[model samples]
Structure formats: structure tokens, C-alpha cells
Target: MNLALLFEDDFVSADRAVLTGRRLAHLNSVLKVSEGDLVPVGLVNGDIGTGLVVGLSDTEVVLQVELSEPPPSPLPLTLVLAMPRPKMFRRVLQTCASLGVKDIWLINAYKVEKSFWQTPWLSEENLRENKVLGLEQARDTLMPRVHIRKLFKPFVEDELPALLHNTRALVAHPGTDTPCPTHINEPATLCIGPEGGFTAYEVDKLVEAGCEAVHLGRRILRVETAVPVLVSRLFDACN
Candidate 1:
């Protein structure tokens, strides 16, 4: 972990926090920190700063924190993605958080397996755990919001139009005529399908909901790889 992400429960007082579990292990084994050392820390959904190690032991570490700096600006992009395989999905969540994607939609596509949603990684606790790893990796404190929509048609027809308001909407599909735009300054809503890509009817629904179908060249990439590439291409801040 690049930054120790402290939740409200970690705080003993306004300026003091306690570290245990994975973070304490990281301090003792990875960092080999002494009582006087300072480490990077950020409060969840709060500010970035440093923590001074005022107390240390095998089981816990006590920190005096001072938060002053704001976290990095979040990307003005809402990612609408097909649910990926469970193993890959966790990594994608981390990558999205690391890349500053604050809005994420995991929608089902024709190719997406029903079993994918049953994975324990989608559980509330696991979801927060993975997102925390991502935030810590990026030294960011603002948490990303994940919205799950299992019914594709209802989501596209009933909700997607409202999400497209005041944002450029694009669906990344292979063999499309329009190439994906680069370094866009405007907010964008990007839809990416499953491994085999979205079925024709699903693509039509998304397009009808106001997304322009665009291509990322002829090469096929896994969902995990495509997300970062697409985000970097669409936003100058990501690059």
C-alpha cells in the first residue's frame, strides 16, 4: 500500500488514529518503521497528508495525522461496463479507482455469464476492500461509486439517457466506423462490453440511448486492458 487509508473507526481523536491488521503488518514488515518515522496517510473520502508514528508495537501502531492537501481531481467520466470474470473484475475495479474514475456502472451484457455476478468479490465487504486497495495505490482518498445493473435492457432504456445528460457518450465497439476520440476535455460516458463484445441488439439499445459507437482499432483487448487505454485516450488528465 502506498498510502495508509484510515477510516473513521481508525481515529481515536481528531488528530490521532490507530493502525492494525494489514496496515500494521505493512508497517512492521514492509516499512520497518520506528516510532518517530512519518508515513503517508489519507482519511477515507477526505484529505491527503502524513502520519507520524508516535506509538508502535507488534499488534498496532498509533499515528498522529495532519491532513491538509486535497486528493487528485476525479475524472469526469462515467464508465458503463459489462460485468467481467470475477478474478479480472477485482483488478478492473482497482484500476478504475487508481485512474481516478469516480463513477462506475457494471451492467450485464449477453456474453456475460450469470455466474460472474455470484462471485464473492461483488459482496459489499469485498467490493470496499478492493476499492480501498486501488485508492491506496493511487494515494487518493475519494471513494468511487459502483452501480450494478443486472437487467441490461431496463438500464439502457430507463436510466442511461439521464446519465448521458451534458456528457459525450460513446460505446467502444470493434469494427465501428468512428475512431475513439483522444484527449477530450469534455465529460464522457463510455460503455464497454464483455469479452466477446456486446450482442448486436444490446449495442443498438445503447446507441439508441445516445452513445456513438466508436472503435479502438482492430486489436481485441481484455476488459481489464481496454478500460485503462480507453480512459487514457478519452481524458487528458488520465494521460
Candidate 2:
């Protein structure tokens, strides 16, 4: 982990944090840090700074932390994705977080398997865990919010319009006429469908809700691959 993420519960005092489990293991095996050494740390959804190792052991590590720097600016982009295959969903969440995507919406598409939603990775705890991994990888502290909408039609018809307000909204489709714009400055909401692509009716609904259908060339990229590519293309500083 690049930045050891400390939650509120991990803090023993105002300036000290204790880490165990996965973090401790990473320190021991990967970093091999010692007492008096400094490591990068950040409070979850708070600040980015350094931690001075005051104590270390097989079970846990204690650090004196100073959190003065704010986390990186979050992307003013909301990513709407059709639920991916369960096996790759965790990686997708991690990618989104690493790229500074602060808002994410997961909706069902015609090609999305109903069983995909049943994966344990979608559980609240697992979702947070994967996002943590992503945040640490990016050395960021601001946590991303994930919204789940199982019913696509209701979400498109009843909610997506307001979500697109004052933002450049685009839905990435492989065979569309318009190419995806690059390095946009304004806030944006991007919709990406499952690997098979969004059904025509669904794309129509999204268009009716204010999204312009756009393409990322002729290549069909997986959901995981497309997320970061689209984010980088749409933002000047994509984390």
C-alpha cells in the first residue's frame, strides 16, 4: 500500500494511529520499516501526510502522525456503469478510485447477469475494502461514493436527468458516430455499459435523459479498461 489509510477507529489519540492486519503485514513484508522511520499515511476522507513510526511489532505498528495537507482534488465526474462481471468488479472500483472518481453509479444492463449483483464484492464492507486499496495505491484520502441502482429504466427516467444538470453527460458506445471529447474542463457524467454494450432502448433512455452517445474508437474495451481510459481522456489531470 502506498499510503497507509487510517480510519477513525485506528486513532488512539489526536496524533497517533495504530495499524494491524493487512497494513501491518504490508509494512513488515513489503516495506520492512523500523522504529523511527517515516512512512506515508492519510486519514480516511481527511488529509495526506507522514507518519513517524514510534513502535513496531509482529502484531501491530504505532505511528505519530501529522495530517496537514489536503487530499488531491477529486474529479468533478460522475461515472455511471452497467454492473460488470463479478470477477472484475473489484478491480473496476479500484480503478475508479485511483483515477479520482468521486461519484459512481452502478446500474443493471440487459447483458449484465443478475448473479453479478450477488457477489460478495458488492457488499458494503467489501466495497469499502477495495476502494481503500485503490485510494492507498493513488496516495489519496478522499473516499469515493458508490450508488447502486438495480433498475436501469427507473434510474434513467426518474433520476439521471437531475444528475446530469450543468454537466457534460456522455454515454460511451462503441459504434456511435460522435467521438468522445478530450480533456474537458466542466463537470461530467459518463455512462459505460456492459461488455456487450447497452441495449438500444437503454441508450435511447439515457439520450432522452441528456447524455450524448459517443464512441471510443472501434475497439471494444472491457469495463475495467474503459474506465481509466475515459477518465484520463476526459480530464486534464486524471489523478
Candidate 3:
């Protein structure tokens, strides 16, 4: 296990403090940390720093910490995706978090199933849990905000323009004439459709709302593969 993982909501201050329960267990057994050792620590949505283990006991370990740096900057991306299957949706949410996406809009599409809107993963707690796992994996502290849009037309017509105001917008479509650019330098708003892809109407609506249809390649890629691949490629192009 990594020395820096997010534990429960432990209050952080300049003074020495004790970490008990699961966190202590992890340090004692998994990490096998000892007194005089420095461990990575951070407050949620706060700063990252080092904690010196000043005392250790069977029940707990005390650390004297000094917060030194601000949390990592967020990726300048807003992902708009059609809700996938329940299992895939959770994975997608985690992926977005791991990639440092600051905002996610789960929207409806013609190919999206009605029941997918009812997935347990859509619940606030479940969403946060998956996002936290991603944050922990990436050593990040900020959580991305998630939004659900059930009606496609209204969302595209009313809210899409404001969302794309100054951000470069890209929509992934398989057979589109324009290829998905390799890199993008500006902040981006990316939209990806469900498994079978977006309907013509949906595509037209989004295009009218300022999203340019972009293609990955001739081969059709699954939602999971397409997203990470596109994001990586975009990063390369921009960098």
C-alpha cells in the first residue's frame, strides 16, 4: 500500500495527533511504519505534506505534521458522457476522477437505456466512494462534481452553449469525417455517446450547440477504451 492514502475524515492541525482504527492498522501492519519515520499525508480538499511519527502504540500512532503545499491543480476538462451500463458507469466515473477531470455531466441519449438512470452507482454516496478511490490512486484531494441531465434537447439547447463558452469542445463519433485531433492546448469539454453511439438527431443537436464531431479511427472502440485513449491523445496533442 502507498504511504499516502486517504483515510477517514481525520482533522489535521499543526499539533501532534493520533491515528487509530483502520488507518493505524494500515500503518502498523501494511505499511509497517515506525517512530521517527516520515509519512505522506494530506487533508481532503486541502494541502499535501509530511507527517513525522512521534509516538506509536498498539492502539494508535501519533504524527506531527506540517502542511506545506496546496493540492494539485485540476485538469481543465469537463466530460459529458451518455450514461453507460451500471458497472461501466462506475468505472468511467473513477477514470474521470483519476484523470483529474473537475466536472462530469452524465447525459441522456437515444441509445441509453431508461433503467440506467436508476443505477445504484448514481446515488451520491456511491458516486463519492468511486471518485475517492480514484483520488486516492492519483494522490489527489479534490473531488469532481457530477451532474445528471435526463433530457437531451433541453440540455443541449439551453445549457450547452454556456458550458462551452470559452472551452474547446469535442464530440467523439466513430465515422465522422473529421478525425479526433491528437492534441489540444486549450481547456476542453468532451462529449462521448453510449455503446451504440448517438442518434443522428442527437449529433445534430450537439453540433448545433457548438460541439464538433470528432473521430478516433476507423475501428470502433468500446466506451471504456475510447475515453482514456482520447484523453491521452488529447494530452499529447496539447503538450
Candidate 4:
């Protein structure tokens, strides 16, 4: 809701785009935008800029848009996470996108609930919708790409090599010898596990796959809280 999001299909000309449906209703009633409001807006996968509101109605609102600049760069981090409960997935996806995470890899863990994977939220369309909501909330374009790995062994042993080619990888576990570093400037690949956390064997596999084992602290954290805490720590460190 921070920015009124629109896609290129809505554009009638370089200077105008027509918004309808729920978006238009939101603009007309929720946001209560008016002529010359100068709304912050962006193309779905393009740029961040101003939209000069020139027209409005109950069903449609028109904006004269000028998209010339790309959004701020995403943090150079790839998040490899054990899929959490379905209920937490949407919130986590939005958090990751809003925080400017570049990539997300959803993997399986021994502690992961089997039923969690059956949730409708994993549907491609539902996933896309959550990501879109995140981008809109952030007032940025450039959707974060999500990847799924139903099996952990295959992903770690076969697919991870290419993904880790140019990245410093780290795995988050509670009982690791070393605490998670305060700051890391280079591109990093971070692995986070499920609620109960990764089994020792799972952690061993990731570590063998070139990920250094690290921890947040003595206290345990749920997946929802761990993601933002870990990402923000890394972001602060990199800066």
C-alpha cells in the first residue's frame, strides 16, 4: 500500500496508465488520491518514479507516469531456507522482498512438516502474488526470484555447486562453534532451517557443501523472526 503499483498493460501511452479493479478502488477510497497528488509509483519490473494524477473515478484512475530510474539494488545475498509452515511463508516472502534480498531458495529439512509442503501457498501463482505484494510494499520493482528444492540431498550435492560459485556461504544453526559474524561485506549465501532447526546431519551436509556453520546466539528463534534478524544483521554488517 506504500506505492500505487501498476503494470505496463495498464499503460495507454507514455504519459498515461489506467488503473482499474481493486487497485483503482484502493486509490479512490482507501488512499483517497486526488488530481495532482504526485503519487509514488513504479512499473511492475521497471523503475521507481512519480505519477502525476490527472484523472480519477470509482472504477478507474489515470496517472501520467514517468519511469526512468531503476530501483535501489538488492542486497548481494542469497537466502537458502528450509521451508517453514505454510502460514509463515507469505510473511517471510514479503519480508525478504521488502528487505531487498536478491534470491531465495526453499529447501527441505528433516524437521519440516510434511503437510506444510501441501499448502496452496506453494502454488506458483500464489507465490508470485506474495512476491508482488512485497515489491509493492517496498515501492520497488525487480521481483525476487524463488526456487524450490523438495529434496535436500540433491540440492546440496548436485545443484548447489553452481549456485555457490561466487558466494561465501554460511549455515545458521544454534549449536555451532562460532557465532554469526557481525558484518560481512562480500556476497553471501545464508542457510536457515525450520522451527526446530536443522538436524546435525543436515547441517553437516551444508557445511560439507562449503557453508560455514554459524549461529545467532544461545537463544532459539522461529523461522519468521530468524530471517529478518539474520538478514538485517548481514545488511548492517555489509554497510
> What is the C-alpha lDDT profile of model 4 across 1-239, one tens digit per residue?
77766777889997799888867777777878999888888887778888888998777888999877888688889999999999999999988888888699999999988898899999988987888788778877888989988999999999886777788788999988988876677888999999999999999999888999999889999899999899888776223
Query: Pairs clashing in candidate 1?
Result: none
What lDDT would each prediction earn against the true structure? 0.95, 0.94, 0.82, 0.86
Residue 208 Cα positional deviation in candidate 4, in Å, after optimal superposition: 0.6
Window of ten residues with lowest summed lDDT in model 1: 230-239
- TM-score between candidate 3 and the true structure: 0.86
Candidate 4 lDDT at 194 equals: 94
Q: What would the TM-scores of all predictions be? A: 0.98, 0.98, 0.86, 0.94
lDDT of 1 by residue, 80-193 (tens): 999999989999999999999999999999999999999999999999999999999999999999999999999999999999999999999998899999998899999999
Candidates 3 and 4 compared by TM-score, better number? 4
- CA lDDT, candidate 4, residue 67: 76
In candidate 3, stretches whose alpha carbon ends up further than 4 angstroms from where it belongs are 1-9, 12-29, 54-62, 236-239
TM-score of 4: 0.94
Instruction: State the lDDT of candidate 3 residue by residue for 1-239, as single tens digits.
Output: 24254444454554555688766887888778889998877666777777789889998788887678876678788899999989898888877777778799999999999999999999998998788767766767787899999999999999989999898898999889998886677899999999999998888888999999999879998898888888887774222
